[model samples]
Target: MTTRELPMTVPSEGLPARVRIHEVGPRDGLQNEKGTVPTAVKAEFVRRLAAAGLTTIEATSFVHPEWVPQLADAEQLFPLVAGLPVALPVLVPNERGLDRALSLGASRIAVFASATESFAKANLNRTVDEALAMFEPVVARARAAGAHVRGYLSMCFGDPWEGPVPVPQVVRVCKALTDMGCDELSLGDTIGVATPGHVGALLTALAGAGVPAPVIGVHFHDTYGQALANTYAALQHGVTTVDASAGGLGGCPYARSATGNLATEDLVWMLRGLGIDSGVDLGRLTATSVWMAGQLGRPSPSRTVRALSQQQEQ
Candidate 1:
């Protein structure tokens, strides 16, 4: 491997030996695009991601077209890449969405929730409890169909409208999701306002609430440039699953202040540097992001992608 494509291995103590990167570029990343990406390109994107060694790729959301127009082609897109040898998880907003995903043979489904009432109202147009109520049956039905269900709790640290969320508040929602039969819970720093201390505290609280570290994943945004630090904190807490978008391609549509997610390339680099296995080829992944950036008609925002691509060009 070229020097630019690999990081020196220096394993960190008290961290997991391997991490499972939940690649969300196709779903969470593209959901906020102003213009629609062609379904063929999106399919190619998923294929490229799988080829890059992302085992759990979130394929698309079955949300109503009115909410996420970019992924309105979910039905058209899911089948094209369903044959890949990787787990393809799709977002299902309700029972209707779950039915749509199930009809397409999606074996893994996710439901999006919020930790704060303000974001719940803004994103789902319901209170937090009401949104959880809506998801209860969705989770139940998905579990019944033998589909792995992931519950995404967004705005876990800070909310744009209601600043500085309490740790206990986030824990309650997590408990609710776990009780409702979610196979896993991804705590989202939707607005990117989380610090390392906050990440540690929340994970600690979740553990206290009987939410084991193995079932918890961290999704951090880089709005405050704290995504990596927060992820390390979660890693210290034995969080093996980390959510990232390839090329840093996502922001929350509901929360305008939220920034792009933690980039997959960057996360892989850190995992490599810390001597932790992510099973992702950095060279292929960077090239994939560069290609996707060309498709998006822009440069990749991932610091590692930019650095590696620049070195390759030189």
Candidate 2:
């Protein structure tokens, strides 16, 4: 079968005129590392991200230490970032997490759910329904405490354990989160198994389900190296918010061979090349990624970085 090619132009109406990029490197990115990143370095990392024109950043997860010992200093991390002008959003897995986030004066929190039942149980230790039930009170408490909540529906495209997740399951979880007062819902392509066609079809289905485009964000992984294409597809369907990591620093520990998120530098590169104004300084952003790679003791995984670094070397 011949694949139909679509124009890659950003639609004036379909795509939100301006999009927001939420940097998740400091929290989600570093959380997957083997060694703990010092709280001061994490704080500085966030400061640099904000300086690079990232308006929203996922600061840390407020879950129990046993689950993510890397973020045990969330209380200190969030407060240390209070001085930044950008919005610092933390991930809260339950009511207890919400309480901890509230105590740290978090103005925004993100909750996560999975589209596949098996991944949900394995990742969150609960069924999909049970996980949603757990988040309802956390959402309520967050709102009652005057904080905005964002929901993340992970494994929307494909799961490591279960392949090719049904679109209806993703829509249902998104509906539940929006109904529970989540101000925004981010659809995560957890294992990066999504294609442009999959991205378009899913967005179309969500639109048909009456989920407003403005309230939806797309989070893509680069595992199969198709994240940028999928991101373009999402933009064509009117998504205005995207969750990306600086230098492609995070990946699913549960999903074997899964790569990090769509790199912020690469995304900025594409957005700028397409004449979309992301308001991010590419040079500064690349420098920040370089610094992060140094801290992590790994070479940058971004293809754009590799190309640019190679050119500099030449």
Candidate 3:
């Protein structure tokens, strides 16, 4: 506990007092890796994240093994961390995925959707409407079973094939998700092309379309170094939930241009500096990321992790 290890607190106006970070490293981060991550390592990763004070960690996805070989051991991984006293949400692509998750006592689930047709087809092999049609029953069944469902809307700002996506288009899909009983909506910047103004405009449009800020989570990527900036904009609009990966370890397997997610350490550092409470222990979280980096045989992409780890070594 040294002064150099933590940032100075400076409270900002019009921001939520506390933010809920939806940690997505295990599922979203490791899904795109070239090497296969073992189920034991994945379980330990989730355990370390929970120990580091991440209350809502995305454990794994129950998608077909043929689709994501890295998470093919979802059944094995989920059982390892199922007893953790935190929210562990897994991705369910369809009814079959939901069945696999529900059979294992998964109480929180997420369904991935797209704001553009190209990503919907590329990632899910279905048109935008078709993907929604597929998820309708999944959401309903999850809700009926008392499981919290999160709807992930990718390419909310821009898409590689569709270019700049319209705000109205994103809002429409978001409304559909909310209408289908999704407890929360995660707005994703799939390719990390969003700017601050664009972030504000979209939040305004969603609000105008009857989507409130409390149920909205911002998921940004650092491909263009705008993830933190866009997140700040979302915070200004009353967004309290954010999707980040431990050590910035994720990219879109379907979209080549999409890069790593907003790092949890980076976001926690910014939140600490802004005097916003995220309920994460910065030192422990940074150490967990550093450990995961070793498991992956690489340095962490998170600037906060590098800087803080260097300070600790010194």
- Which 10 consecutive positions of candidate 2 have the poorest summed lDDT? 1-10
On residues 209-229, what C-alpha lDDT tens digit does candidate 3 reach at each position? 999999999999999999999
Candidate 2, overall lDDT? 0.86
By the lDDT metric, which is better: model 2 or model 3?
A: 3
- The TM-score measured for candidate 2 stands at 0.94
RMSD of each: 0.7, 5.1, 0.6
User: What are the models' TM-scores?
Assistant: 0.99, 0.94, 0.99
Clash totals, every prediction = 0, 0, 0
Task: For residues 173-290, write the lDDT of model 2, one tens digit per residue.
Answer: 8888899899999999988999999898889999999898789999999988899999988898888898899998898766765789999988987886576778887767777888
Candidate 2: residue 193 Cα off by (Å): 0.4
| Model 3: CA > 4 A from native | none
User: Against the true structure, candidate 1 has what lDDT?
Assistant: 0.95
What's the lDDT for residue 151 in model 1? 94
For lDDT, the strongest prediction is 3
